[model samples]
Target: MPQKDYVKTARPKPKAKPRASNARRGNARPTQGANRPWLLIIITALLLGSFGWFLWYLKQQPANPQQPPAEVSKSKPVVDDLPVKPVAEPYQYIKELENKEVQVEVDTTEREPQGPFQMQCGSFRQAEQAEAMRAQIAFAGFASAVRRTEGTNGIWYRVVLGPYDSKRQATADRNRLQQQNINGCRIWNWT
Candidate 1:
């Protein structure tokens, strides 16, 4: 194949229109728009009339007119007899429990003394669940015991953490378990 030589062709330049003389430019024809004097007058008159009407309407009435005397009722019902409340007397026995000492009398009807308190974190039907709860409690730095108790409603495995000397200690342990995201632990007397 022979390689042919390519020649670049020149493009035709566009000619500019000749500028008119200053005198002819000044005398150039105005736009041939229709003479609408009636339309212009009517539009101007309407705008002025509407503005005047709005002003007149505003002046005719107040922004907030006072209500007439007949519209407002002068009579309001008066309370004839109001109930008299009896003065509340302060009860004598609401002393500060922490500051005051409470003495319990030993009664003949009381057969046995109160036992140590215990906290039961969970009660499960399966022993494995009880063991898991105990393991969770152990991870939370608590030693727990799982006991299998047979009742009317089948057997139940209880996860307990007690034999606490006082109920306060049991409550504290329960609160600590709650802090470890273990909830629903109730403190009761350990049998």
Candidate 2:
């Protein structure tokens, strides 16, 4: 084969076609940063305008000087009524209540406790455990005592609350302990 000289012809570079969005918008195509400064300027102008309006509004308002708190006066209250209302008949309930003996007849009579009530918080074999429980109960604001009682099982230490005058009082104390998350307190008649 005869040697053939080959020429690498550089075809005209294809013109970069405009993007579809840019082509549709034409000259209105937004630049990466063109509106940034304008936005800042507009926002700044709005803020300044608002501040100026606030200053003008403040100037328009009548200045109310702060007055010292007035002492309660013993004078009759000033009424601003066109028609003088007949002085409201003086409150008669107070006078009637003073003379009236309100006999509140309690309909239900609760059965009273037979004797002084007591609350037994816990019975423990060890004195130390009983003392620790008593300390915890004391922390909750109740005075408790650890009494050592010899039972058929063995010597047991009882953590007792009180010789409460009433069952209601003993229940109240137990409820208070319950609020402190202490459970298993039994109310018994104190010997």
Candidate 3:
């Protein structure tokens, strides 16, 4: 038995082709028209619309010009010149006015004791300071007096203004104290 020999074969090469021209292949110019006419038409339409709007604005404006306001006339008041007469009195006479009134003797009774309302301004540690403030208040034409009272902490000397019947009067007095440049003075209702 003999082995047969195998040989390799070479194939023929392909030739290079030439490039085609665009003009001969009908690919040079554009088939569609230019867009300048459409743009011009849009611009013309916008201009016509704006012109119509301006015409409508001119028609909406008032035709007559504005005029100034008229002046108002003030007339003088007329009064009567006749002599005035007095009218009759409403109350002329009273019958048995003194006889009908009852005559009774007035009783002079003694007045009851009145309790004063005490307003506490502040508690001072020193009695001298309280006394000094009391003196100042007294000198200011106020009937002021100082009283010593015992508190839970210690003894307190209270400077009181008066037994003012009303809180309004007491507040007025307090304001007067403030006007006098007196600090640490406040209104207190002491009943």
Candidate 4:
């Protein structure tokens, strides 16, 4: 069997056609005119329905009440036309306090010369007893001291309560010492 080869042939190109101008189509007026009847129908229906709704809403409202008096509606206040009130003096209240009698009592007893005071909790011949007293005083929240002094008999250790600022403070220390069952506490003057 023999095979045949196909030959390709070129045809002439198609001629360019001329297009019609839009001006010659007379501006397409008829199709636009056809839409007007339906558009008018829709607009008329909307207007009638809105008029019906407005009529219904008008019937739903309550009857109007009598109008308010003109004087109450005026923007300026009636108080502005009235006379002003007189104000009382600012310091008038102080005169009442000045009239009341106040009696002041002054202390007559001379205060002791300003020196730190001390309370003697115990006088012991033994240093250990004095140290023990000092420890007990410290545990009771007071700072105490042990002073060694030579007496007529021998050197003694004195457990002192405080170097307090005033006699009343020293008295309070003596009371505290009494609470601790050491009733022989004495107040002493110290510079």
Candidate 5:
């Protein structure tokens, strides 16, 4: 068996050199002048300078023009402004009776005074409700007690504050209780 020889090769062609253009090879094709950021910068600076000058000018101006002072009266008015008539007193007899006392005989049929002031903090048909209100009043720092009484209407449980003799003292206590958010409290004169 004979071996065959595979040898004869073809010659390769040379690559052509790329020709440079006159514009690219430093032939002074006017280079687009260094991108003009300076113009934008100068414009911005001028705008800022103008804005500062405007603010300075505004600050230099006066807020208002000068004005003359207001004239004031030197003397009081001559005519009286009040009405000529005097007010009538409501209870002149009570004022007159302040110092003097006159005694006269009267029947003893009138009921005797039981207490000073009778305060009804709550009036409820339900005894439990009245009792609850009484407890609430006591918790809120007022001396409260529940009392049941029968009347023509029906039986009612009343939360009583005090049997104060003086109405003024009772009124003061009522006001204090009211300030503490206690509602439906009233002073009564029970004989």
Candidate 6:
């Protein structure tokens, strides 16, 4: 094993050339999409200018020869199919009663006035339905009242039983209503 000398060798690295400036590169390739912002601005300006020109052109053009306003018929088209029925005049007694003042008897001793508990049989949006329910209550031999209440949605017709003198009476009325197979009867307080 003889001694061996190790020599250090140096390697040279290649130098990178300077990059072209954006301005020079822009001039070299005029159609290159490098300046996208400028292209977008130019396109937008053209669009806005055309729109403004269109509006100005419209203003310069003479107002379309004012055509005569369309004639609107004052009368409605009527279809005369059924014969007209005559309306009955009011009873003569009503006019006589309107001018007369009559005396009435007081009977407050029978019992305290009815309480506020009322039995609501049904609520309906349609007048016909409410009327039908009222008729049904009449047929059932019970006096019912229709209350028209306006709410956010629309008018509501509520068919309700009397505000009985006590809760017991109201409960009894509800039971009677249920026996007749009439469901959805709910008690409500007037207060």
RMSD in Å for all candidates: 19.1, 21.7, 30.7, 30.3, 27.0, 26.7
Q: What TM-scores do the predictions have?
A: 0.41, 0.43, 0.38, 0.40, 0.42, 0.39
- Candidate 2's TM-score reads 0.43
Decide which is better by lDDT, 1 or 6. 1
Better of 3 and 6 by TM-score: 6
* Best-to-worst TM-score order: 2, 5, 1, 4, 6, 3
Candidate 4 C-alpha lDDT tens digits along 1-191 = 87654443255558899876656766645557666898889999999999999999999976664765456657766667667776876677689888988899999999767788888889999999999988888777788889999978999999887688898989987787678776788887886
* C-alpha-based local distance difference test score of model 4: 0.82
lDDT of 1 by residue, 1-191 (tens): 98764543355558899998756889755554556577888999999999999999999996667855445446865556978775874664565554788799877785555779888899999999999999999999999999999999999999998799888888888888899999999988877
Candidate 3 TM-score versus the reference: 0.38
Clashing pairs in 2: none
What candidate 6 gets wrong by more than 4 Å, as runs, is 1-115
Error of 5 at 33 (Å): 28
**How does each model score on lDDT?**
0.85, 0.87, 0.73, 0.82, 0.82, 0.83
Q: What is the lDDT of residue 115 in candidate 6?
A: 54
Model 5: residue 81 alpha-carbon error in angstroms: 33
lDDT of 3 by residue, 23-65 (tens): 8898986445463678789999999999999999999977765
For model 4, give the 10-residue run with minimal summed lDDT.
Answer: 4-13
Runs off by more than 4 Å, candidate 1 = 1-113
Candidate 1 minimal-lDDT segment of 10 residues:
4-13
Model 2, span 1-191: residue lDDT tens: 98754543345657899667765767666886776898889999999999999999999976675865557667868657797678777688987988998778786988865898889999999999999999999999999999999989899999998898988999998999999988999999866
Better of 2 and 3 by TM-score: 2
Q: TM-score: which candidate is best?
A: 2
Winner by lDDT between candidate 5 and candidate 1: 1
What is the Å distance of residue 167 in model 5 from its true position? 3.8
